[model samples]
Target: MDTKLLQEIEKGTKSALIKKNIINYYIQSGSSTITELSKVLDLSIPTVTKLIAEMCDDGYIEDKGKLETSGGRHPSLYGLNPESGFFIGVDIKHFRVHIGIMNFKGDLIDEDLIPYSIENSPESLDHLCKIILSFIHKQNIKQDKILNININISGRVNPESGYSYSIFYFEERPLSEIISSKIGYRVTIDNDTRSMTYGEYLAGCVNNEKNIIFVNVSWGLAIGIIIDGKIYSGKSGFSGEFGHIQAFDNEILCHCGKKGCLETEASGAAIYRHLKQAIKDGASSILSKKILEGKHITLQDIIEATNKEDILCIELVERTGLELGKHIAGLINIFNPEMVIIGGTVSLTADYIMQPIKTAIRKYSLNLVNKDSKIVLSNLRDRGGMIGACLLARTRLFEI
Candidate 1:
């Protein structure tokens, strides 16, 4: 074997790798004693102590008092100083963008929401860059302290090359490189669904689950698959296009240029469109009154109406939920995931949606698969994508 290949196999010098691992372990575990670090890193006590001393001197890690030992002297606990670094996580949607600034411990320090539509053109790119720069400037933090920027957007993203095939049309440059060059910080981009799934896996309800599926039910539906304890982005990093899966044989066209896709009948956009059509057809409901008052019915309006037990809204939500559940049942039969996390804005209507989804899953999925899979609402809610983006940035920059 070549010497270069051997070096690659070793990752780096032993000391450098050990230091990196130590930092990552401290970040993940919150704090660690010298003996604990030594055991986890499989290094000598003296070696671990030396590296910890160096890190403490360099202002990376700090002694966080001591941990009570069973018998001997108390062991000093070392943790990453919260001020050591910062990360920015951006969650982009078609009509809005959410930016979160997180500390080294992954706690969100600050956040900003920009209500702006992102167009699929260069002008939009310039506007996005400006928005990001403005947000960072307003945080009153040094640019160097902001270590990494993780961006999560809804689309088919090629993680390796940072090419977003679903959104920007800049054929000549990768989106990550373009954003990084303009923002003056390293950037990493991922699909919004995948990022949310990763966030759940890291800190939400799906923590430590080896096999899990996160279904994001928003304006559109998307799935994030975790197999064997890692995100499965498939060959092109576009694995979870669950929204586009065929759910009906009807002629309703989808944004993906297909007819009868799951999103066509089961997404928030679909529910809104269907409600509008029903009102136009003289359907009697409270939403119709809102329509008469020249107010457009949004997904939120429908959810509110459903809570009020308005027949039309209740029917619409249940129908959409059933359609979504059918697709989810198919997924359960295939993946046999330990957990199915339902997230996104639409998930807020948990009372109206969960039961229908459960009904459909029971009806369509095999007994064994349906019984084993636990479908639950996401705890992180809207923050999952942004949190996941921050985690992505940390993992990429720190190789954690």
Candidate 2:
């Protein structure tokens, strides 16, 4: 190698080390006082001060005024600049796609959702690309000012390659590469359930605990596992495919071409199926009107029906919860996670579902694992997947 190039590499290496330390401090403190950052980073006050000043000059961070003083000068607070660069989060669901934009603080500055389907093989990606491109154009932000684009998708993913195994229409064309190349920014893609779990970890959930499981109860069931603050993508990039685990010996078929899978018996799709049959059998509820109208029954319809004290819907949800809890108890036994986070539209039935879930777990799980683990709802809702994408991109920027 040329000596000049070698010298530049050394200089870059040193700079990256300093930046990594500073970034770690910022992420740990959430937002830090300069003195605090300096102390945590173990640097002289002046050296740390100058480094922060330089980062501010480069538009990476900003002074956010002062902290409380205790008969002393108020120390200044510093935070990642909200306007420095924007990150876009796109969540592709079974029925729709939600797009969100945020600055470094992860606050939602803008968001919109539109109906989307994978039925059309060629047009799906085209439509998705158009939606994102149009969103950026309408915002009037320079393309170069966008730092990263993050996408969350429902289904199996090859985490190492950022490829979706189920979104085969985009096969041979990695979605991340396509988006990044077209939009002139870094792009990230991951399984939606896992993304949401990562978002909870970043938000300091589980008392900042490390091992966590985020279970998404949606049209299909899925789980995201985080070990030591990182996603545990197993061999062949397949881990936590809990939905396909056998939950029953019945004849119900699952989308993954399996019979008696957990999702076939316990997912939002399963709940919808039960409600449709009950309504067909003359069960009475406001949803019966929708059934009479020949309209599609959604997870929301079941949730509302249960909330209205519809006996059949309540029974169905309780049964589903019991099935889910059994699956969860198995996970608790195996992983012994510190926390299990439940998320998705089905959690709307959490009130009707939680007790039965706990009942099943208490009935099956080992006392020790069950004792230390707490099951909770995701704080970020559907937004967790998108936020996790941003964290995915942000971590890359600061990682070794």
Candidate 3:
């Protein structure tokens, strides 16, 4: 399982680039006959054969028995050796972290969730680094085989520079570089919403729809936009701040220090605040006793309450969904995406939120444009972020 061989590929060699293309093809299309590879990679038969043989000997690619055929001889198939490389994806949230492991073939082989806190302090970053290293050590694989790590943190992350401007933003050097140095591995940093969007696009319900939007309704609100089959990062990689668009007239100050932002009404933080105020105003619901006892309620508890048929919780969640959809209708009039995915911690409440979101979109957006967009829930649920991190790490590492 040595893809350190990849690190040695010379920058300018024709054969070196061809070999990378072959591997990339397998990653995207799975196993294929050399004949198919020759045609797809646009190399002569002899060249494809020679390189395929060399890759086999170098342990970069391996022989699968043959492609199934009806009558004639089955063509021999070649594909990447999944053991050659591994990737780790970590999705860090406010009080928990999810770690996932993926092999070279783009399969999520294993995953885990651990309770943790993310904060803007050197000590917090140090803890994040140590926990990642510890998690790696606990897995039953060679450390060198784990070629890269991708960390998905909530905030403004310039993936090109690996700098997070919000969570764990207490450093001059790139956070990816810091974690890489500590863990002794190549690392990439990504935005949590973007990572989750990638997860939903590749592993969720997205299928051939090039234009899509993923709205994350979590502790905060943001979006992941895919345009023409690629994630749209805008001009400065700071796109998808969907919740910050000015939409209200009230003086509800957002944590971003802005007033009348949609997040002040639609995010998990907003829900928590509103729910507490409702209870304080003597509204009785399933959580009334807990609220009276001063027990802290989490987004997860609200989701659970909705599932338990709590009337007040369901109403608040629907209100958030309606607010979110109202803003998304404006997006539809602009981008007219084929699909809009409702995800994040609050999304686990399922249709308790989605119905209102869809209702708002239909009510506000143009009928022609809104009908073109299909609203759905994330199939991967809360798992999208970590899985997306692994994908980002794997594919981006291949670019290098």
Candidate 4:
């Protein structure tokens, strides 16, 4: 949020805090009658009634129709105004960006993708800012109506301090602050994997499953954790760096400059590397001809071949899934979560990716612990990060 806004919120009194509570309540419960809200918020009826009037006058909330009552007078419902504010959620990849806008009610209103390549440099950072502003202009969204811009980026990001350790590193100011200056809007940045996890938790399947783990098997690998029904960002918001854990004894270097990391053997990068090598070793498959020609291979191409029953592709995919599951089984032993969600580009392979992971879990994890957790694929799939960023923007807005 802006500095002035933060100052106001911090200096505000008890009534201000209660107003925040009311906004958060509507966000969580959709809509509620004054009587219901008073009971839930532990406030007097007159107090809630007055606050409701103030919020309505301030254009933050609105009065919906009354709820039907059998005998006594029907109670009117108050809820957030859907158009009171808007949020921009950006999912940034190395070479792609997904931009979307969401209403205050957490509904995605518009989404678009841009082929914007980003590297760890000042120029790339400025390029991202231009793209965001351009998107807003193209959509004709008023700057005043936009509440904040929330970005989901891959790598080591400490969301609390708004500093990104992996990309656009700076010494003086946090990345979010830098971007905010360029775009003239409040900016919030978080780990992409964590945002994807939140997206699935809020909008995907697995209804009300509190303790959860969302495994993102993309070009690289990472995880998002939900503990006690809240997104678990550890000391520096780096709690779910699942891919960097050492799981093998090898010399292959990972993107993080470490050897023997799980990412070196089980990520989308692993599948691509293994598939290409297998094809070079006289393995016959749909991707073999492309491999023989020394053409670039993408994870999507490999997944398509696997879905078409290519033997080499299938083996490579299953190997990745099996390795992922073996490691995930250890997590089950530790966390005993209620659900584990598999997501990202690799998940598009569907059964080719899921079956092997399921097998490894059944064979490796304790039956008792594994039984408490149901492992499944993400319902949001490729859209998780984008949608999650939008939801993140909405939820963080009321944190003041």
- lDDT by residue for model 3 (38-59), tens: 9997879999999898888877
Off by over 4 Å in 2: 1-12, 42-50, 66-75, 182-184, 204-206
Each candidate structure's count of clashing pairs? 0, 0, 0, 0
Q: Predicted candidate 1: what Cα RMSD to the true structure?
A: 4.4
User: Which candidate number maximizes lDDT?
Assistant: 4
**Where is the poorest 10-residue window by lDDT in model 4?**
1-10
TM-score of each: 0.90, 0.87, 0.94, 0.95
Report how far residue 321 has shifted in candidate 3, in Å: 1.1
Worst 10 residues of 3 by lDDT: 3-12
Clashing pairs in 1: none
TM-score of 4: 0.95
What tens-digit string does per-residue lDDT give for candidate 4 at 1-400? 1233334456886777888888888876789999899999999999999988877877778888988878888888889888888989999864588999998778888998898777888888888998899889877666778988899988899988999988888667998999999999999999999999989988897697889999999989999999998888999888898999998899999989999999999988998888877778777889788789988766778878888898888888899999999999999999999999999889998898899999999999999999989999999988899999988888777764
Model 1 C-alpha lDDT per residue in residues 1-400, reported as the tens digit of each score:
1123123325766666667788778756789889888899888999999988877766667899979768978889999877777889898864678888888777788988787777788888888888889999888676677878988878699877888988875767998998899878878889999999988888788755689999998888899999988789999999999999876898987888899888988888988888888888889788887786778455667777878888988888899889889889999999999999988867877768888998999999999877888889898887788888888777666553
> Candidate 2 vs. truth: CA RMSD?
4.2
Number of the candidate with higher TM-score, 1 or 3: 3
Give the Cα lDDT of each candidate: 0.82, 0.76, 0.86, 0.87
Model 3 alpha-carbon drift over 4 Å, by segment: 9-14
- Model 1: lDDT of residue 47: 92
